[model samples]
Structures are given as structure tokens and as C-alpha cells.
Target: MIGKRYTVPVITLAATRRDVYGKALAKSRTEGLLPVVVYGRKEQSASYFVALPDFKKVYREAGESSVISLKTPEGALDVLIHETGKDPITGEFIHADFYAVEKGKALRVSAPIVWVGEAPAIKLGGIVVKVLHELEVEAFPQDLPHEISVDLAGLETLESQISVKDLAIPAQVKIIAEPDDIVAAVAVAKEEEEAPVMDISQIEVEKRGKQEEEGAGTPEQGDQTSSP
Candidate 1:
């Protein structure tokens, strides 16, 4: 599903001012500014306010792995979305943490899996399941992918499976997950066997027969009273 595209998308967000806290932070959000922090290896952590709309646009595409060009009054910084916080009730974007990454340094990041095409096994009544959804990878900021495409076309039979080794990744990126890790697979659904039905009348007869057998092996009540 992954193919080389000539055009690379440019994601940018402008940071306008310093930290906005308490009532001021709430006021900034009401005014459409999102409070964010940018920091990374060998870089000083700094707080800035970004436009909510602009950040949403970049986040939709860049996610947390892709490099985002953060424009500040000081200069442009290449950063990654380290973490994000959202409102629990409304699910609104509340806060964000961006990591400033060095140009050529390798960093560990998680990339989401994107499934493409339909598995042939699924057409034949086999269930297709994604065993792994995200892949941990080590790569330079520029080499990171927004999402790794996993082609379901490889699953031709019920026993077919896709592993990390089968993924098509760029040479510059290194997958942190084991090569034997399964990405997707197809399995034949087993038909559930119906439980055996019990014969109530036959069970009652058996109970009676057992009672009669025990009674025959025992002495009468009068004979037992004389012995006592």
C-alpha cells in the first residue's frame, strides 16, 4: 500500500508568545490559542502558544512521528508531537508537548499501522486480524513515516501471516520490534459444536435402578432394629 510519492507534505505551526497559565491559559484557549511546550535532547524546554486550528492541521498529518516545522520568533524548530492532552468529556484539544529533534540524530518513536487492500483469505471465509497495530521504530526525524502501510494482499490463505520482516521500510528506518513479530494474519473460523442433549427420562430410570440395587444389598428395617 505504501508507495514513493514525489511531493512531501509540509506541516507548519507558528508559536506566538510565552507560557500562558491559570486563568490566562484558559483565556488563551477561549481565544483560539493552544498552550504547548517544545523541548528535546540538548535543547532548553520552552513554552509557547500555538493557534488551535494550525496545530490541528499539523497534528492530523504529522501525528507524533513526522517532523513538524515549528515557527517561533526566535527561529524555526523541527519538532515532533511528543504527547497530547484532551478534554475527557468533550474530547477537545487541551494541551500538547512537542519535542525538538536534532536533524540527523536517531530517535525512538511509534508509528501507526495503516491497512490497505483486502486479503484474499477473507474472501474465502477466513478472518483477517491485525496482530500488531503500531510499530516502534528508530529513525531520524526526517525518515519517520506518518503511518506504516501494511498490505493485506499477502494473506492468500488461512495460514498466511504477515510479519515485521515482511514490512517494506525505508533503509534509514530501523524497526525496534522483533522481526518475527506478526503484523497481520488470516485464520479459519472453527464451527462451534453443539452440546449433547441429555435424556431426562433415562436419567430418572438410572436413579431408580441405583436405589433398588442399594436396597437389595441392605437388610430389612426390622432385622436391623433387632441387631441394635
Candidate 2:
């Protein structure tokens, strides 16, 4: 089991019932509201709106894996951030999808991996390589963890490594990934010397100089006298 758990922040959103397509969506952005949809077990998919700034704050803290409570007109809903849409030009949030989750229901989600403590091998010129960024886990909605912590302090030598089976998670949570899958490792950092860059213009000038020297050895047509 994890030694410490992060507190997931709760965010409230006002339910919107207005049109969600065409010009209405553009207007919603101008008003600082983002269009969002919520759907999941025991509920029909519904369109709604949330404050953009508030949602962005939650996104930065909770990310997509952590569960957050969404307050709708119906009541408080436990949900996970399923996905989000961004504007390509301005890099702004455009839309969001929240997956409603029921308490006591088991669901599979990708939990992010967080590395803690510096590997002792790093001081010996060893490079720390991350073998996996996230792990697939199944747990009840309330038991879902925000992130899995991997302690690098155990890596005392370059040959030391950690695998999925080494992770300490809550008993309620089950990692779906293979136990033999490597989570991280420390290895000797490969040092490569930079190769000298050749100057194309210098090479071209040298070739022209050689051609001129060869031409000088052979008399020109006009320079060729009767003694040719």
C-alpha cells in the first residue's frame, strides 16, 4: 500500500442546457464557458457546460486519471476526466468529456507513475531509464489511486532495476500489467564524441584551386606558340 495519498481536488460546474453546436459553441467560449459531455454506466449521455478557468485548474492538478466530483443539477457525480479537445491555433481548451463512475464499481484506468527519491547509481554516471510511464489498474471508483509511486532509492547499482511487481499499491487496486514488465532501470550512460563538421564551401574552393593548377600546367590555346 502507498505510504501517502494525494488529495484530489473537487471542482463544481454549473449545468448548461443551451445549444452546444455551431455558433453557440463559439459564443460559449467568448463567455468563458466550455462545452462538456458526461456519460457512463446507469446514465444517458448528456451535454453541459463548465467554467473554462475552473476546469483548467482542475485539469492541471488532477490530470486525466484522478477522479473528481462533478456537481450537476441532478446532484454530485463522481467522474474521471475521459478526454479533452484543444484549439490547434491558440492551444486553448475547447471541449471536455467526463466519465461518470459509480461507487463500488470496478473500472480499469491508466494510472500515472511518479518516481520518488534519486537513484544512488545516478551519482556514478549511470543514466536512469524509465521503462513504463503508466500502469493499467482495476479498482473500485472510491479506491482508485491518483498515481503510483516508484522509489528510485533502491537503485544502488547500475545493474539494479525495478519491475511492475515491485510497486506497492492498495490491496483494493490490482495492476493489470504483467508483473515482469520493467518499470525503471539504471545503466551506464553512453558517451558519444561529436564528429567534426566539414565545410562544403571550403571543399568546393579547394577543388577549383586544384582544377586551376592542372590547367596552368597545360598551355592555353592562345599561349601555345610555334614551339608547341
Candidate 3:
């Protein structure tokens, strides 16, 4: 995560029915915002709200691998987005789930895959293949890693393969994944030619989006995660 952090101030709002929540939620989402409820280990009810754009900025800073500070009127608390809702048409953010955290606690998060170095196979006109774009790991929120990088220049042929066991890790990071997991590998080289255009009779526009994913609850893990 190479971006600056953003602090969002949340206000308490009670929407008893879906009708009320819908109207408030719609208005919040329309202004690039969302409603969130924070329930932690203490079972505290911190029903709050936040702006989508503000959440995005901090989420980017934490790189999705670590926890961030959630600033509220009461005080500042560490947190991570457990879930978020996005607009279907504009593909913008709406509401998000904020999970409480502490730096001293152990947590698990996924790290993004980073391809480093130009492979000899790539320069040899081989098609570079990317696999295992993200990985799940457990660690302290403060110790969460931004990404895991694998150097491809060492690969001499298509037979070369890099597995999760071969991944380089910092001393502070512990490996908790299976060693046999394939991180990336080189495929046989392919040749590329100029663009070939064809007449299109049918075109279907599809929205690119993702569903909110929860952590299935935090467990003791020691793996790295991705960039913001």
C-alpha cells in the first residue's frame, strides 16, 4: 500500500426498517458513501457510517493486508473492512463492514502476488503465465505484508516452476501455507502477430464487480497479503 491514509468520521444513525435503511442507504451510496456496523470481540455495538471514497483511500493505504485506523467521534480505533457493498450500475462503493482490531493481536489476511524480473523465457518469445494472484496468510494486523513478489528472470525454460515454498519471505513473516502450492510457472512461448479484426454481430456488456468476502473469522496465521 503506497497511498496516504484517510480518516472518516462516522455518525450514529438508526434505521429500524428496510424502508428506512433503504432510503438512508440509497442516499449515502448516492453520495459515494455507506453504512457500517462495528461489532467486535467485546460484542460492542458501534453502529456507524462512513464515506466510500474515504474508505477506499485508507483501504488502499493498508493495502488490504493490514488493519487501518477508524476515526470516530468517541476515539480512534483500528479496523479493517470485513465487507463492502458496491453500486451495480456505476460500479461505485456503497456500504462497508468494519471489523475492530488491535496491533497486538494475531490475524490472517491475503497478500497479492507480485511478478518481478523479466524472465528469459519471456524474452525468448514465450508467453508469460500468471497464476495464484493472491494468497491467504495470518499475522498481526501491524505485521501484515503488502505483497509477495517472485522473480521470473531465474527461469530458463518452460519447465521452470516456482512454488509457494520457493517464495522469499521476510524474517518477521512466517510461512504457514503448503509448500507444494504453485505460485507461478512459465508456459511454452507463443508468437504474437498484428491485430486481426473481425466483424461483430452481437455485443453484450457485462458489469465487472466482486462480492464482499468475510474472513470466516480470524485465526492464528502467519502469511503475507497484497498491495492496496
Candidate 4:
């Protein structure tokens, strides 16, 4: 089910953004609860929380990178991620930030950027500089795409700069970004130094040697390494 694409409903949040809390979110989600805040549609602003399992289903269906529908008990709406918080101690979910979406209206979303072809510069010992990891696009919900990829197989020199206009975008999808936006390019490689790996035995040998030099007895050594 995870491998295949699916569309899951993200229910509108009932409480206002200020009303949401950390502990409440974790408990609600763990007990088959879903929590989200939806505010948009030009004054149709209200937050509603959904079931956790249902929300997980949506995340499973849509790559977290893509937008999904938020079907509310009151009405259905479109929304996307703003942020998701994690627990400090246990590293569990603390909260999620959501923004409402309106179809046919321009919306800004962060979509992934990909590389299409093998880099010619890599073969030439040149470094590839990926300046932008993601792009903020202005388009409708349906128009919003999965990802944008740039080819590097033809790039061999640092003089070339690949722009957004060079991307082979779909006819239905119009990139709201500038055509000259450089997604990635090749650069000259810098010399690097290698560091030695400190093995357990080597570390113990060094420690024992230091201890003896300082008039301390050597450890009865058989490789002092601890197993997890």
C-alpha cells in the first residue's frame, strides 16, 4: 500500500491555531487521532483536527512532498504542509502546521528538485553545486507538480549554468518560477585531506601507552570495545 500512490483525506481543524498544544497532539495521534489547522478561502478560516490513522493513510498515499486533500466533517478543502514538530526527548510528533488551499488560485509550495542525467563534470573531477534544494512554485493545486529535474550529462565546464527555463516541464504544468533560475551547475573540485579511522584496538593501544608513560599500569588488553 505504501508503494502505490493514493489520496487520503486531511480533515479541517476546528480549533484556532493558538488552541493547539504539544501533548494534546501526541495523545490524539497515538489514539487514532488526526490534528491539523486549516485557514484560507478568503475569510472561510477555521481549524479542524482529524483522526491520526486517517492522516497516516494520507501521508502513506501522498509522498510528504506532494499536496493532499483535507476532507472536513463540515466541508472539503485543500491544504499543504507548513511544518511538523518532533518531541524533544522521545523524538515523537509534537505538532503539525497546515495551510488551506484554493483551486484555480495561485499558491506557493516547496517542491523537490531532481537531477535527470549523469554529470559530465563529475567525470572531469568537477564538483556539482546544487544551489537550490527546493523551489517555491506559484500554481494551482492540480497544476502543482511532483518534482523538477535538470540534466547534467551535457555539462562539462564550470562556465555553464542550467536555468529553470531549460527544464522539460509538462505542457499542462507551467513553472511560475523564473526561466533563468539556476537549479544546479558544475564547479571545480577542491583538494581534500583524508583522516585516519581510529580502530578500537588502536585507540586502546594509544591509551595504554599514554597511561604507562604517565606512570599508570597498562590495561590487560584484548581489544577494549563495547557491544551495543
Candidate 5:
């Protein structure tokens, strides 16, 4: 399932050129816009603003690997959503960076891994441990895939494992990882250890001893201080 190719619709996002500087960036967000920048191999970087709702929809569909058409005032530019910034507390989009795709050039990006099918080892009381969530790959922007699917059915036994080399990658894409690197593996689940039991009698004895020691240091309740 590694090299498998699937067709994905070309995703497009609308953006407007933004010249806002300094404190104005906050104003853009208040108006339902997100500040973003676009740059490429030999292209000039430019700042722009995109609708928050529209950008969110495109991000969900294109992710980081897939190329999307960014419709700007100048023209439509083919780009990839390279990075994003968010409001830590509110989880709202604050900014984004888009990588303009250069035609005829290969781009190195991380492709997310999608697990397909249920591992047979899981039914046998074995747990599947995923080691890699994404693979670093290089391919032409047009050949880039939204994601790489890894079939879990290959894991039949608890000892079964999948390595980087086991992935069936597309002919155009090259994986930038060690061939022997384990991608996923199945292992026997460990039994939960029992909690240590406390000795109630020993605890009670220590508490009583502490109380008696404190009482010995105090004078009798009826005793009065001797007059000097």
C-alpha cells in the first residue's frame, strides 16, 4: 500500500493581498481573516490574507503535502500549505505559510501515514505500535500524494513488523529514511502490575507511638506553672 496512487481533486483557496503591518495583523483576524505568506524556490515572498473559514476548509482537504491553487488578486498560484500558527488557548488560526510549487522541480515534504484495515495480531491480544506517523518523501508537486496508506493486514503475528523498505512507494517518489527503520510492529501486551498493599496494623501502631511521644513532652492538664 505504500506506493499506491490515488486521485485527489485540486483544492483552491481565495486570498487577498495584505499590506497590513505591526498592530494591524490583529485587526485582520478580528475581521475573520488570517494573515499568511507565500514563498517558493525562486519566487518572491508575499504577505496575504485569507478568509478564516475558507482557509480552514482548504487546510483540511489539502493538508501539507498536497498542492492547492491559491487565487490571489494578481493570479492563481499553485502552492502547498507548508506551516501554520494558531492561538494556543483558543485553537484558532493566527497565521499560515504557503510554499509555492516550482514547476519541473521535486519538492521534499512529509506525507502523513494512513492506517488501513485491522491488524490480525490485535485480535490475538497483541498491540500494534506505530513508530512513524509520517514519511519524508521527495516528489514532483504534481506527483505528491495527500497521504501514504499502510495496510495493517500485513501484521499477522505478534512478531510481525513493517519497515520503511516494505512500503510500496510510487515510482516517482523517494522516501528519505533508512530502509531498516521500523514503521510499525505488533507486540504482546504486558499485564498490569498489582498495587502494593499497606499494612494497616503497622500504620496504626506508628500513629499511636507518635501520639504517646507528644503527650510525654507535655505537662499534666491540671498542673500549674510554679510561681517564681
Candidate 6:
């Protein structure tokens, strides 16, 4: 999925129906368009294409979790950016999948965790360790948050920690992650060990010894003899 929360107004993207079996996919890309599919719980799947630049702008704001309106020839459909495929080499979005949101139905998604504030433990020579980066939650499309904020100020000591239960989530949302799971913690920083120094004199002696051994195995130029 590609969106965050519905903090901003719903974005409207113009879409045109596409031929799924046609050879125009590559041609569409060259024309600055992105191929996409829209499907819903009860709605039949349909293929379409939207302007690449417009889709990129929407993706930046909506991500995979936010709802956006797709204006097609048939009608306008509210959908979420369910998934996307990118070119491995160029990193360009090759295709996208939009999941239509059913009215009054709840959606399950992983909301990103954004760390805010500074941990006091850092002043005490302790480092902060984050365990989880996202939280699994269920909420209506309109109620889904773009991101959940985690306050690092709670970590005052090396032993102090934050868990999923400590998050400040909306009343309309239900957390699916374990309540006891650690989200972030502080730990005492470990000192790096110094690397041992080597003796240059010993290396020179070993090299000389190897040279002598090789020299002893070969016959001198003046000592060459022919066999009968």
C-alpha cells in the first residue's frame, strides 16, 4: 500500500480504461502513463492508466493507506493504492494496483511509526534502539492515520522502554500488534576494542627466511650440468 492518513482532501486522478491483452503497455510508459488495476470486494476488476506525473504526486501525499478518487469513464471510484511495481534498474513505477474501499467497511493496514522528541537516555550515554518501525491496525479508511507518532522522551533511562500498548492511537482504530511488544528501548553504548598492532621487524624476518628457502631449492647458474 502507498498512502498515509486522510489529513488532506481526497485527491482526484483522471484514469482511462486500458486494454489488458493489448501490446500497448510499453507504449503507454513511453507516453508518460502508468498502467494500473482497480478492484473492490464486490466490484469487478478493471484495468486503467493514469498520467505518471500525476500518480507520482498523489503517491507522495496519499501513500498506500490513504484514499484517493479515480475518475474513470464509467464513473468515479474511491480507492487506496494497494500495491505498486517498479523497474528494478530504473526504479520507475511500472504498474500499480488500487483496492477500492467499500463504504462503511474497515481496513487493515500497517501504519508507519514516526519517532518524535529526543530521548533523555542519550544524554546519559545510552543509545536508543528501535524494535518496530510500523504497527498493524484496523480502522475505517477515513479513520486510518498517515503515521503514528512515538515519543522518545519516555526513554529516560537505559532500562526504560516503550511498548505497543503505550502508543496514543485513535479511539476508532484497533491495534492488531501484541500489546507487550517493545517498540523502542535505550541501551548502554558498548566501547569499541582497539585492534592489536603488528611488528614490522617480524614480517621482514619471515620474508627473508622464505626467500632463503626458495634460493636453496634452485641450482646456481654456474652449477648447471647435463644428464647422460
- Candidate that scores best on lDDT: 5
Residue pairs with colliding backbones in model 5 are 2-168, 3-168, 3-169, 3-170
| lDDT of model 3, residue 74 | 70
Which wins on TM-score, candidate 1 or candidate 6? 1
Reference-based lDDT, residue 9, model 1: 65
Write one digit per residue (lDDT tens) for candidate 5, span 1-228. 355564557789999989997787888799999999999877799999999999999888779999999999999999999899999999999999998988888889999999998899998999999999999989888888788889999999989999998988887788999999999999897899999999999999999999999999998778689999
The count of residue-pair clashes in candidate 6 stands at 9
lDDT of each: 0.86, 0.82, 0.64, 0.62, 0.90, 0.86
* Residue-level lDDT for 197 in candidate 1: 100
Which candidate has the top score in TM-score?
1
Question: How many backbone clashes are present in model 5?
Answer: 4
Model 4 lDDT per residue over 1-228, tens place: 012222323433233223456666555667654556656656364655665555555554443445666666665556676666666896655455566666677666676777777777776777888878777765556556656666776577766667777676655455667777777787886678788776999889998888778775555558678899
TM-score, cand. 4 vs. native: 0.61
Worst 10 residues of 1 by lDDT: 1-10
lDDT of 4 at 7: 32
Better of 4 and 5 by lDDT: 5
Backbone clash numbers for all candidates listed = 0, 0, 10, 12, 4, 9
lDDT per residue, candidate 1, 7-107, as tens digits? 33667889986755777788888888889988988789888999899888889899888989899989999999999999899898989999999987888
Per-candidate TM vs. native? 0.84, 0.76, 0.66, 0.61, 0.77, 0.76
lDDT of 2 by residue, 55-144 (tens): 988887677776788878778888889999999999999999999988877889998899899999999889899989988888777667
Q: After best superposition, candidate 2 residue 139: deviation in angstroms? A: 0.8
Better of 1 and 2 by lDDT: 1
Q: Give candidate 4's error at residue 219 in angstroms.
A: 60
lDDT of 4 at 24: 62
**Deviating ranges (above 4 Å) for candidate 2:** 1-14, 190-228
TM-score of model 6 vs. true structure? 0.76
Our model 3 lands, by Cα RMSD against the true structure, at 27.4
